[model samples]
Target: MTTPSAEPRPRFAADAMLGRLARWLRTLGFDTAYDPAVHDPELVALAAAEGRVLLTRDRHLVAHLRPERAGLITDDAPLDQLRQVVAACALAPPPALFSRCPVCNAQLRPATEDEAATLVPAASRALPGPVSRCPGCARVYWEGSHTRRMRQALSRALPGWIS
Candidate 1:
């Protein structure tokens, strides 16, 4: 297996059962496609088209056509499911945390301070950090207490994987 620094992070497509895991993966800056309402066959086809490893908890999804890039998520809990994917995919440590939109799986872009300041409250504008905006969802983001909480969770989910 390749070491964390050597391997490129794998793109992923999670089945409906692994939606939360997919969000976490996106939060970790990985390209993760997730839709809780998509049908199984369409999900499989999407994964194939995107060249992503399809993470699923369904036995039938795995058995269907024996998809080469498919992986079965054995754990029911979210973090444990993440652990499985990290090990099975030989994932590299994420290069950028909080770089993708967890809700939409879109890469975030830097927002001008002036532009962001107009959106948040006067007190929030005083906080020091770059602001980001999701193109797909038009949601704003910044490093704050939520970042700390997520970092803590990732520390537990994959020890030594994040700072």
Candidate 2:
């Protein structure tokens, strides 16, 4: 399969209705901005200031945005919405799965062995793969069965998007 574009991929902001979609985007390492309580005006402004494509289910919100600055979500399911956004935005596959913090939308860094010792659960540290940490929220990440399940979800939802 072909990658998205030569230019940098656009970041995103999802409306409150698309919280799940936002998290999924972050799962694929996209810098997505989402706030469950943000108002339409504020969300629009945030997208504009940050050069983000606003993904929303609200037609009224779509009306206020320039066509390029908005994506109208037409599906109820998160995975379907994800497919639509991925196509509309011409997104590329992520450099690494779980490279971004799904909770805070921050890029995750590889955790030092010392940091992992303190932050990661002993059970998880023993599982395999390196640990990662989100600087924004201090949440730690490690490859575990959950990560494998998430990867499988991605593989099913988006064929050939993740390896």
Q: Tens digits of per-residue lDDT for model 1 on 2-27?
A: 12344387788898999899988998
lDDT, candidate 2, at 127: 87
Cα-based lDDT at residue 11, candidate 2: 85
lDDT of 2 by residue, 30-124 (tens): 88999998988889889878878888999987876543478889989999898888787778788778889999999999998899999888778
Clashes of 1: 0
Q: List the residue pairs that clash in candidate 1.
A: none
Q: Which window of ten consecutive residues has the lowest lDDT sum in model 2? A: 1-10
